[model samples]
Target: MSNAIDFISAYNTIDSRLRAIYRGKGNLQFSDLVRRCAEFNNTVRKYEDDLLLCARLRNVIVHESKKDRIIAEPCDDLTRLIGHVAELLSMPPRLSVLREKNVTGIDAEATLAEALVRIAQTNYSNLPVYRKDRMIGILNNRRVVRVVGQALERGEDVDVFLQTPCSQILQAEDMNRFYRVLGRSDTVQEAIDAFEDNRKLLAVVVTESGDAGDRIVNLLTSADIPMLIRILEE
Candidate 1:
């Protein structure tokens, strides 16, 4: 009984927050809050299943008469469900969790050898290549290997090939597959979606407003998704 009450309380809290968000967006109608939330791109679109389940549970508890109690004993699953809903509603994790002060980048003028040294020192597979302050491309091991392999196949001197500027290795056709820029306010689910949707996406760069020109706040790779799921589950 206590657990059921707690679940109801959790649902109410979630509903309240959703209502606030809706109103903030100039949506005054609260008759269909769950549907409104579903339509809102920035909030709860990914958690529609969980939200629907909570709505059904809320109905059961709210409509139950004093003489009849349908949810007498709440199990661990119920507790976990409520916890997830609360976390999603109250404080979903953002890209800032991955933010770092020092993000290494290779200058477009830098030699492949310089980029390789940075990669060796940091063990970062994807290094953003910049020209002045603008990001031109990413310097990853696969691209570097491909470029160097082609050079070797053409009988180019290995020493000379290593001195090639980072800009020469950036193929115009392949830039879209390398990385994506996302806003700092974007939810972790959006980041995961970006990776899952793009088979060749190497990294997600978090910036102030998801603009390519904004200063990158953090970087996320495919390996971070599992860790992010664990964090969300907590």
Candidate 2:
């Protein structure tokens, strides 16, 4: 197919997907759609200028034409760029793209010392703590340090605190604020946005159905931010 045809096809795909996000809001102009979607969608925001330029170029290609003659065609490079943007906006890579395996979790009944040992062994700063196979909260090093510091302030027996169950630590976790849950359908861009939106986010839990009650399919820490950005860029 001609570059004009290919570019138009990709542009339509992006238009359709953006409109779907705001269904029942009445028909929106193409430029308006890009501007509004950019407010929440990282992919759109990243390619906002390119997409707007494509919109202008599309007008030139479609309107400045005579009967049975094409006026302009998008260059091959621009065509591919818009096509890539369309794919990302429409169906972005999921958490599975990370191919995370053997995601470690500690039992809530386990001692802080045991949890520390597991953290050391796995070299993961954020460890999911579970009760009855359901994830309750993350036992990250920050929380551990805070709890220990408070113990020292009170001059309590440090060893006794180390022996305390992880469940005690989980009690202080405000799961709704400090952590997020994303399901299988969630995209990698969404995960990136989640971290970008919340600086205090301890971890992002990926489950089969995006519920806290569901077993974790994967876990994301801030340390994974660089890799996540690389995945999106590539």
Candidate 3:
């Protein structure tokens, strides 16, 4: 609200939610913040600002929990969780060498089968699908089997079935603005959290000013973030 991006006193601006978040710093992930906060009455939703912030944190918690294969339900107070998320989201994202993504991209015109072969050769879980210099979407290795199975079911050519651009599968928009948006950070956790917060946002797109706006770089599930985290640690 101050337009200064200082969340240090964001709690002072809000109600008891700040207290809730401050109280639960032990469970640091986003979903836990939401789950813990959800246990509180609906009071969190009353503060529209706090509610929206908590929702984003919730997404982070849910996503990370799934990636780690944790059976956590994240039960904490909502008001506290909202404040924590507010502070966290206001901060810029962290980046890694993976975020550097020194890898080459594939053309959208490539056949699905060809792309699969390339992906296989590289041993990557996903490939960045690009239309020229612009990143379009991601081709996930896991989807190959499903595509093949569907091809077998429909009696269609897997090559043709998969020849389309990866944008067809980009759960978010393709934009240049997201490129390097995460910048550099002190920890992999910060970078991972940033990806969770903005991976599906307009920040993924490129604007007419040649800026990264509403742009998605490549799809990086919470799973990918951890891998980057590991790589960064090494």
| C-alpha TM-score for every candidate | 0.67, 0.82, 0.40
Residue 204 of model 2: what lDDT?
A: 86
Top TM-score prediction, candidate number = 2
Weakest lDDT window of 10 consecutive positions for candidate 3? 201-210
Q: Give me candidate 3's TM-score against the actual structure.
A: 0.40
> lDDT by residue for model 1 over 109-205, one digit each (tens)?
9999999999999999888888888777778899988888998999999899999899988876665777888888887767877877797888888
lDDT preference between candidates 1 and 2, better one: 2
- Top of the candidates by lDDT: 2
Q: lDDT rank, highest first?
A: 2, 1, 3
Q: Per-residue error at 231 for model 3, in Å?
A: 10
What residue runs in model 1 are displaced by over 4 Å at the alpha carbon? 1-56, 59-87, 99-101
Q: List the residue pairs that clash in candidate 1.
A: none
Model 2, position 185, has a per-residue lDDT of 77
